[model samples]
Target: MELPEPDTASDDAMDSFLDKFQSQPYRGGFHKDQWEEEFEKIPLFMKKAPSEIDPKKNPDLACLQSIIFDEERSPEEQARTYKGEGNDYFKEKDYKKAVISYTEGLKKKCADPDLNAVLYTNRAAAQYYLGNFRSALNDVTAARKLKPCHLKAIVRGALCHLELRNYVEAVNWCDEGLQIDATEKKLLEMRAKADKLKRTEQRDIRKAKSKEKKEQNQNEAVLQAIKVYFEDEDRAELYQVSPKSTLLQVLQHPRYSVKALTPAFLVCVGSSAFCRNYFRGRKVHQVK
Candidate 1:
């Protein structure tokens, strides 16, 4: 049986219907084109393209096999690749980038103790340069845990504490480093620097405290002088005396008796000219 001749009108209608269905707004399926546009807007560093990050597809079997087979494609090699990249950034003083590279190397999870220690220490160095002292200290501490005698880690940890103004911790870390390699020039130098800084800081604190105490003592002395002068009926009358008022003029005031003036009091009043001046300038004090 021969099929009926195709109807051009119905064929065009069917084509139009299929075209509308195909072009209908996607409800939730992955839209690669739209995703690409949005993905492009993200920073290059933040964008992990699917092809580059598919764990199932790109399993690190080569790295694992190298560890098992002792081949060059080892985890160490992979970790070192990122570590070397970090070192290059560090040398160029690109500390932020160095931190990123070091972090990526650490994510490789290499089992080599020395490599892990170096990775952590190098990251700490980058963090130090970036003024992330707390983060640097944390990384250095991790390095120390891995290899307690790691000289670079010890030095960096001490410096991190120093930057944080934790002089005591800085001194402690420096001393620990010194215990390992007493002759190591950098350790020795850092220890001495930390010690000197700690001493200087302590001295400054003492000086500040001493100055505060001296000010307090001086204030107490002034208050004592004021209290003594005001409480004495004989000297209380002198408080009203003007700076230019003479001793003889003050003595002649009705509030004081001529007989009440002691020889020492008269001598003090005559020498200073004014009670306030006498109280302020004289170390010896007497009131009657």
Candidate 2:
């Protein structure tokens, strides 16, 4: 077949290059013309080709639609192409574009459970990176629903819940995910934090309850002591009796056992001995 004649300007440029290259006399057996002929056969080598930019066009939804209808490319290849583009977008941190690419890929090959989980999981990661925790959780949930055995998705979902301050749900998700893959370090860490928070909250609640109980008990004790003091004849009569009468009664009372009251009366005796010892040591040190 007669290939289209080379463009005349390209042909002239090639001839000029070869002429200049051959004019170097010391370079022998270079076969500059033959080399030029061979180079010309390649479409790109002949000239500086015009740049072909992929126009900054809106996503070609039509092309995607046609790809869906076309039976030529295997479903796997189509998915691969979409996923490759999606990954490229992800690397660029263009998460919205990446999600679109992954979603389109999923539409083509919905039956691939692993791929579905991976796409959704990746989208969830992007969402999380973008600080859209709720959306990320949704994607993770969708992924887990499709592939119930997806441990990574479960962990990521738990993390998302944790960021959203749903501590109980986060712990629940981590617990379930750990049931499947216990060695997941991040899941364990997240669960530990959630449990710690729960414990701290519980401790605060218990402390409050204990404080109220103590106050109630103290109030009840004060009431009982007041009632006893008012009703007891010795105390009540002491209030009415003169000091001399009380003293006489104390001296005369048969139940005023000094031995029984000895321990109670010695409450300050131990402290007095310790204070004397401490004061003597201070005095000796000052003298030294």
Q: Residue-wise lDDT of candidate 1 within 200-253, one digit each (tens)? A: 999999999999999999987664443222223444433333435566665664
Each model's lDDT comes to: 0.73, 0.68
Per residue, candidate 2 scores C-alpha lDDT tens digits across 1-288 of 999987999989999988988886655443665877545434445352122322233124334446654668876667767777778778878888787787777778756777878888888987888888998999999999899879989989998988887888889998998899889899999999988876787788899999999999998766443310011223322111222343445434443334544411111222355534533523111000
Q: After superposition, how far is residue 35 of candidate 1 from its true place, in Å?
A: 34
Q: What are the per-model C-alpha RMSD values against the true structure?
A: 14.4, 17.5
Q: Model 2, stretches more than 4 Å misplaced? A: 1-71, 201-288
Worst 10 residues of 2 by lDDT: 227-236
Report the alpha-carbon TM-score of model 1 versus the true structure: 0.52
State residue 258's C-alpha deviation in candidate 1, in Å.
Answer: 37
At residue 68, give the lDDT of candidate 1: 39
- In Å, residue 144's CA in model 1 sits off its true spot by 0.5
The candidate maximizing lDDT is: 1
